[model samples]
Target: MILTRRALIAGSAAATGLVYAPALLGQGKPRVVVIGGGAGGATVARYLAKDAAGALDVTLVEAEPAYATCFFSNLYLGGLRDFDSLVHGYDRLAAGNVTVINDLATAVDREARRVTLAGGQVLDYDRLVLSPGIDFVEDSVPGWSLAAAETMPHAYKGGAQTELLKRMIQAMPQGGVFAMVAPPNPYRCPPAPYERVCMIAHLLNQTNPTAKIIILDPKEKFSKQALFEEGWGKYYNDMIQWINPEFGGADVAVRPDSMEVVIEGEVQKVDCCNVIPAQVAGGIAAQAGLTDETGWAPVHPDSMKSRIDGNIWILGDSSAQGDMPKSAFSANSQAKVAAMAIRGELIGSRVFPAKYSNSCWSLIAPEDGVKLGASYEPSGDRIASVDSFISDTGEDAALRKLTYEESFGWYAGITADIFG
Candidate 1:
């Protein structure tokens, strides 16, 4: 008897490590395979399926069954929100006719238009969407690596790491020191590290009031610097300190084993240390040969379609689409544009001009919140900021409280939009 690859994969699906049986390829409908199920991939998949109305076969392959959003995770760290609140499952998407595969995508063959999963199954697609998000750059911070994450947690991704950092903070001895080695620019979220510092300070104020917080930043100025500093002075009352490049923040190293931070030649021991290194597009994007010298996948500003390969689209933090900050709101906005473009190309749906907007809201204290945002449109090969706005320094307490409440509403709305 002769056996084909398809027959072999089907017959030995269990033995070959296929967690979910491979979907039938070459269906009458055009296939869309989306890898990564965060804000970008999830929103795109949902949009395509709902809009196509059975005209397209959409599959989402996410490594984790449940996704923990990094956007509002700082609130959890600050004891303002619970960990469970940040987590979302894929069941709703699966129920809506989107094939939700809980497995890791190991490889992609552009010529064959196939994606190979770690579970040994292959998915053939007419169109592919890559939104695998950010990964740490190796050696970006000397002596800090994935192996050392257990000791000096980055907590920048989501879920477990965020919880771990909170636990470390709660366990700190009285008046102990908490240190953070912030990352450089063009990161996942420009304001995340600073927000993390604010959240940690908020937590320590209640639990360990005497504890000191230190921020060793490589950049001279960070997102909403004045707002955060003002909040620290008003709320934290000098409990937090920021060390910039002029004071050895640029030249820094870490000894995870000893929980030590070395600024220039000076070494300091701390009760907890959070090391956020430089970042790049996720490994899968590079493995698929979609990324460029910038370590990010370049996409057309208007359509979010890959510039390297027309059949693929890149969204979220993984995409280099100029002017847009790498935030969940930005990813969600890009996904909508990509969904429209994909539908138009595959099934002749009407395509419209793409417009994008993003807002990043951060909480400094209990009811103290600040935000920065911008609108963008395609200009010359890049997305250019059309207009921008930010909360002013020394805003009245009522406005700040309103902003905090507005963020809560946004969190609920965006999560529903992504997961549903």
Candidate 2:
């Protein structure tokens, strides 16, 4: 009886930690186990199932019953969309071929090529795909931990936290203060915190016009810095105050009990706080020993295959690939490459050369949007940008509105591509 990694993590290996059916290995169709059904996992699972044409046994393991995308969550926060619009289910994924398992994947046994769920179900796989997304470094903030998250919402991962933060904002007193403790470099969404500030300001401007936003960013510049600054000047002039590390963004702490935010040992009471800490690969990747010292899984840029375990592929925010930012579009693109390679290995299919692309758009105000994106190819050992584009700082309203509308179309197309 070997102790499964799941039992060790759950502390359930108190006694025998026996295996139920060790003989289940290599007995069924070539198995493909996909963990964490987010942007990366869902897309890979769909392609593998569809491309295999029922030739491979594809199983998707996701704990959450429904998914609320973190990509467009800012629009919901901005009052531009409803929460239900962002919610999606996996029922559509079961097209009489793919098997959907809704349960927490406690651990992955790489050597035995099996996945152990919390419910005691063991899934043996021929190959594995992990797309667990980002997890925070709890100790990144001195006074902020998971417990304090109730007082200071990160909302970095979409779900109840997003709702909680929205409620806190709506209930904020007039002329109150909103503080955002931004994350360091190598985060899930590079432009998220800044885009969030714009959405928050929009909501506050209509309700609590006197409220002010204070962004304490560790980095001097952020994604869409010029556009965001220009929009802030035009729409909420002098309403948003950004403090870089040069001033006081580096040294910061939070006291949720008193709702006090301390920067450089100078404390000020804030009505609400959004704390986004440093990020790392999803927990399952660490448990499986796929991640390295950087706390992110190292993968081949062309195939998205984990360098540590050739049988497993890592995608989305979990992988430390190349220059690509951790964006939804990037994840979907990477997933396709992985899916194609995996399918080619499982069945005699044509594997094409890998070419990936990504585009990220942010809304500063109503119909006022900006974008930055690029297409990439494998260069030496990393993904190199071949062509790129970004919105000019002084783009007119018409172009900005078109960009915003393009984001909506992409949201619909990508979600359908992932779920359906």
Candidate 3:
């Protein structure tokens, strides 16, 4: 119920005064520099400080003082949750003795083992952990770029863009069309875009019943394909349409200025368009030179140590540790493993074999939630799924309601685990 981090910290230093200090490592503790404050970075920082009991200095460098989680942002768009509820501050983490630095990490000097911040601050670390989420891949979607985000809002990264998309959807004319250009594989949150479609449909069903929802997806198949399709048919009727590659979904272009989508040379005007282009490891990860040709940082299957650099570990969406979907749950799970490994190497704590797990839940209609999960272990050079489970199609109403409630519990529990 308390999630992995809290469950693991039962016997450790659970309460401690906050500390902010210079990034130098010679003050009787090995310093750790974490380059993102999302689920992975925050979890690892908290774990190291709590478990180490001041034996290590953990400094988390994140640009945002408060993080808006992309995990449940769809609920906000659907009017299921408030925007404030999705935003979390770093006060708890700062109170837990992890030095929180609000600055953009601009460069990583691997040979010198120092990080340079945009504010002209330098941080030195014995072990550097990069969890810098995802960045859009340039030219992945034709005629779409970061500059075009304002007109065609991706809304994939959470926060303002999400709010913008919700506003755009709300402003659509009656019986208008809502179009979503779903991302290809290896993007953050495999089922998120589809879940967004469901949430938007839920919103539109009440406000604009005649509003049609269209999905132009590049992938042939998606996560929870059967479950989503079942829920769509049952709740949305003829309100939603999905077009795959054979139907020009793969070849697409968008004109944000005109609010038009071109599919296989067929142009269509839409009231709202959500373009989720292809993505790569967040820019900072690639800046650190920890990423491979795949545009994601490669880590060892067991410890999450960067395959390119032994002194650095990568986590979450930035990491390409095979078989793990880039989700918050996977990041939290991987953070614990990395924290334990870092402690064992730096301060002589006991190290155990890495065991990881992740569960992703999506809401279709109200009280209709579906989930998929897997237990993983190191297999050869990758983290292989050992066991897995998913919600079955045509599950009873009570069971589906229970699954929805379970997701609520998981969100609260995981946020506490990551932030506190």
Candidate 4:
């Protein structure tokens, strides 16, 4: 059998004489395979490998050699942060005995308890944790597919497309229209599209005062509607425009090559367009047969264990946790609960109910930030919100600055929690 990337990493570790002890295999140690080393999977791997000590074998599979966080990506686009701030090193995870595999997962066989890599290698697992994150709903709009992403940068997942959008915005001529097509409900980062609009608008004001940005939102109300609208008014009053679902911004079709946004009955051609499509679980989760028609996997709330398979657990954007918005913070919070549950199960102990918390921050400007946060606990069959917080409308400058600082701190803490 061909060795997968993970097997190669493990083999390399063994070759380096990194304290390999096969004698420790049968001592209640359960092998756990994690798919997708993003916010959720990385955190789970770190915690499980560190806390479980020698009682758990942790392996992480990810196609990307390095991770670029979506959280502070807007700051990079806005020229407020550097690439170094958003990039993380996985040395801490390696130090915790977590084997990292840089490869794509092609298939997952639940019955055989094995994950197949694209290079035709199978990895068996005692417990499987999946946090592959979201995938675009290709058919959400006409003529919109992964190929379309090259021209009309979604920038939702914050990678190459993000830089593309920023470059396009910088090159746009004055008086040009920069259009943004927001996705429907239950998508990753509800405030993201709005935040992108704000950041782009900020740049436009400095370079091209006559340039306009139109937000075509499907939802009548957004995550932080009042605050975002207020920021737009205070910063760039006449330059920014928003059309809610009631006003024909709801239904949209895109032509990536032409850079046109069709809303209601009219097609509006623009210099730059961002179409953030509806999202579903990443491809690996769907291939594993863990997800249903809803594009998400149903899991036991307390344990994050898949309803379809006993030993498989799904986390982050792939798992359908009731009332949880698909945010990086939520993923980080869920990782802890899932790790604890897995630890409990491995020790033959009853897994207790889980609790989670999440806070999402949107930067409107260098000095302005808006946020919505909530804490929740498992209730009967769903996660119930216990308390919440939001940046108050019309706050003082000091408070706004405080919120901005808090947002930076959150980005640092969460990234550390995941990669460190």
Candidate 5:
């Protein structure tokens, strides 16, 4: 369980110190500059460092000192986990002999094989991994912008935005209205906005029972819709109302000053709103010429290498690989394959066929959880799901609690895998 960097040190040590041997034929170790030290980037960096021993010089560039995962932020909103519980540092990856840089990645010079940092540091690399997650499409929601995030919070990203949403939920007026505008398809955590609504309702039931939640969704159907509806009926009957696109859910605009949501030309007052808009690959990907017109980076289905630049790879939500939802698990899974392929091409490491899997778990109420999972492999031009599983809607409370417990274990295991 202790996956330390010293475990990768090859050959015997001398009496004075260790005499390490390189795995590659080069003046120095083959450099790998990973941008966005989240699930995908961090996991790849760690895997390369561990698997390659002293052959690869891995550097992870991340602005934040610690990453607060958006996956379980809903649990934090529901008071199931503390804020600190969702946050993870890079200490484990650093201990794995990876250079963990605490700075922003500004740009990627694909031709030069260099990445520029926010602090004017140019990092050259033999290979680059870009997994910077999502960035929103500006003006997708009328009158909603980054500045308006203070008033109408979009807690899609983790950290401060999540805390802001939590506070807004707690600050709701007695018997007030809480509204949520769900994002369009092909975004990070497909079922997350609905889960956040459930967590908000759970908090409201504990604090103010009369408060209502209105969900304006752009899509007609959502991930785990049947399961969420079942849980909502069982736990919070008549407390939540979901309106889909056919019912004017898609035609909506927000006015933060008046705290009004205009849906289908009908104006309604809401105490708070969680507005999640359409998203694309992170800025760094677009800047690096890795992304296409679809706003996501296109990659080879097998190894996740960029179609535009072979030396760079895309992972996680930023990657437009078919059949994979943009979740932390997907990113982590993709990272391993990319790491393996990169190592195989760079060094003399044995490579295997690419396989990927992901499971997204959502909490409907306290001790009530449901999950959807799939296993995928490379097809002609996409990663197609070969098998799938999901939690049943009619499962007993014991099973639901067990599912929730299983999610906790996954979080622990994945964080360890990525960080270490």
Candidate 6:
């Protein structure tokens, strides 16, 4: 199906449940089944497990034993941060009365309000919180499939592919070309591709000064454009090239064996390629009938309850949250709102006004970083940005250092909020 941005927005509004004006809070505990233990899901699990006490029964289902964050993945590639730093354990959630199930969820039955796992175990819940994050649409790019990913690592989700991409960079010969094909809009971490370029350039400048990096972006503008350009000009003037979609950089098809990308009928060969394909809600969400043609679930802004299934709440990158960018920070914030709404609903209470915020930081170098942040609130039918902040584009040695420091602090605080 051809997924347009407008269709996703309109579908979200229609699916949301009508507000019932809460009555006296009930006393019976409600069971919550949360899928995907990443940023948003982990945060919701932690909060519900911590505060629910005897009021809510929380279970978290994650396909992985541990989570590796994508926020500071560039630092890992640059050898600035160890993989251990980005790794988070789920013991805290378990301690807080959350049943942490490290297994794959095969299907979600909206009618039965149950989740079926690969092992044949079925989990029933009073409220379902889904934050499974994103999955690439393989058909979005011709010639790109699961097999092709072996040669061209997306590395957008920061797992094995991230390690593979790092090794590819290390193994490339000096003066080789490293090509990156960035995805279109509404993907996770809008500035991530640019951040990857900056980090890669930093590594090349140190070891292989003659090597060059190229970015083929599908969008005319990117997040933190001025800051990224300013840093590139100041540090790696002739080492990097950026081709916008209008100028023929939007290439989706990849010949993995040849390391070639077809852009507007022209094929270009490269030594190393990082292909980030277009994304949509994860398979579970889509399979559950929560998603429409646009590959995103619509939810009530105040409650985060799915429009298609009133008992289910969608959070993080899977939900069409109006103007909000799909970032870890935004997901974390939305989880809190969803948690509160769920708590109120299970106990016959009135839902209150919801407020959300997010901040995204991109490191240009080991010691240099830039950031963008915004605050959001629910409007008539969608969430609207109310305020925003961004770091200055120019490179100031001291300010850049401070930015990196702040980035570290944000990471620490967020992980703690989700797991501690």
Model 5, position 417, has a per-residue lDDT of 92
Residue by residue across 1-420, what tens digits does model 2's lDDT show? Answer: 688644443443222232221111223578899998889999999899888877787878887878999999998998999999999888777663566677778899999999998877787899999999989998898799988899998998889999999999999999999999999999987988989999999999999999999999889788889889998999986789999999999889989889998999998999999999999999999999999999999999889999999999999999989988998899999999999999889887999999999999999998988899999988877888999999998888899999999999989999999998
Error of 4 at 5 (Å): 14
* Residue 100 displacement (Å), model 2: 1.1
Per-residue alpha-carbon lDDT of model 1 for 225-324, expressed as tens digits?
A: 9998888888888998999999999999999999999999899999999999999999999999999999999999999999999999999999999999
How many steric clashes between backbone atoms does each model show?
0, 0, 0, 0, 0, 3
TM-score for each predicted model, relative to the true structure = 0.95, 0.93, 0.94, 0.93, 0.93, 0.91
TM-score of 2: 0.93
Report every candidate's CA lDDT: 0.90, 0.88, 0.91, 0.83, 0.88, 0.83
Q: Could you tell me the lDDT of residue 284 within candidate 2?
A: 95
Of candidates 2 and 1, the better by lDDT: 1
Residue pairs in clash, model 6: 15-307, 16-307, 26-347
What would the per-residue lDDT of candidate 3 be over residues 1-420, giving only the tens digit for each residue? 656533323322222222244233336589899999999999999999889988898999888878999999999989899999999988888777887877788999999999987766777889999999999975988889999999899998879999999999999999999999999988999999999999999999999999999999998999999999999999997899999998999999999999999999999999999999999999988887889998999999999999999999999999999999999999999999999999999999999999999999999999999999999999999999999999999999999999999999999999999999
State the displacement of the C-alpha of residue 229, model 5, in Å, after optimal TM-score superposition. Answer: 0.4
Off by over 4 Å in 1: 1-26
Worst 10 contiguous positions by lDDT, candidate 6: 17-26
Error of 3 at 392 (Å): 0.6
**Error in Å for residue 384 of model 5:** 0.4
